[model samples]
Target: MKNTKTPDLPLSIRAIIVAFRVFFHLGWTKISKKLGTDPTTVQKFFQCMQRLANGSEDFWYLLSHIEPSGCHHPAPLIAPGSEESLEVRKAVLKHKTWMRNNAVNYERSKANLPPLKCTTVQNICLDFKHAAANPKYPKRIKRKRQPCKTALDEEDRSNWLQYTQDLEEAEAESDILTNELANKLKDQIQKLKDTVSQQQKNAESPGTLEWELLQQKNMEICAYNDAHFTPA
Candidate 1:
């Protein structure tokens, strides 16, 4: 059988995929014009990209960023120490544990439960974010996500594993480099208090992109200093 597992994507490719999805919502014609491609081609390419993003880490990250605009059936604000709240907490924990061990198919589970009561607890527990926040429930420990793998020969599988490992290491190293650079800049600024004055001079210069960026940074710094260092 051919290996059918979806391949991992680098951060840059993931960002592009997210942008494509966002832009796609505007219209196919707009995307086609921007890409200088035919509408049909853009649509087909988008379908492919959507499938690729479906089960990827970036896709989950994108999902995490989504915020519900409104809740029609908002959960009632039960006092934490009250009898109703105690029962609600128990029901939430019970359903949470049940869902963890079983397929999270609500309708299928509903079939096994007594009529009318079937969806009662399920509906409340379906609000995973709220249900999972039971202060009485022990916090679930998080683990690093494992890469999805496809069936392959020993050699090919080994190579794929190595590639994923290297990809994760590269991402970690990139984050470390960013932190190191920021720290270096902070130390330099502290050691040379005149650095801000020098940057201000460069920022004042016109026409160049570097000067434009410096001016923007100076403005941001001024706003931060005003907010933090100024007296009330």
Candidate 2:
């Protein structure tokens, strides 16, 4: 069997559906029979139409077949990419704006709506109402994180490894130089200590020799004085 499902359509097509429902007063089953769609789909479309008609004067104007300024502009016939098509597109957009504004004012006049209050509280209330009537927003999906990867090429990796090896070799050389310097300092310190100890021993031996020589010289001097002259 051929698929009878109702594909999503433009607002104008939906407007025609609402017109059919309103003019004929058809139930879901009868409308579904005529449209060759499921009764459930027809019912949903009707509900959507009703909500749009109730909320929008522009939709009401579409249903009522009110033309804006007694004229309609068809879509541009030129190729969309052509320079001339830009002007045609602008005209079409301007006509649409006129249609919306004129239709809204006409519907408001017919409905006898009061002047809208511009107070802060009224604006807040309107914002809240619009928010409540809004369809549920689609939830943002979190993107899966990509796995971490190294950006290093083979040349870079080899260079880094070579640098580390060179550093180790330099450190080893520095340690050898430091040990040689320490040994040299130790030998110089030992030689200085030995020289100081020898100098101290030589100074002490001179004092002992001077004492013995002075005593011998004193005995010689006393014997000379007694031999040279008698007491007068």
lDDT at 218, model 1: 92
Candidate 1 global lDDT: 0.52
Kindly report which residue stretches of model 1 are placed more than 4 angstroms away from their true locations once superposed. Answer: 1-150, 194-232
lDDT minimum window of 10 residues, candidate 2? 136-145
RMSD of each: 27.5, 32.0
What is the C-alpha lDDT profile of model 1 across 1-232, one tens digit per residue? Answer: 5322213323443344447656445465665455444555445444555454564435555544332331123544544345443454454444443432132234335546322242443443344443455457533322223455557999998999999999999999999999999999999988687876666677677965669897788999999999999987
lDDT of candidates 1 onward, in order: 0.52, 0.52
The candidate that achieves the highest TM-score relative to the unseen native structure = 2
Candidate 1 deviation (Cα RMSD): 27.5
lDDT of 2 at 39: 77
Measured against the true structure, the TM-scores of the candidates, in listed sequence, are 0.20, 0.27
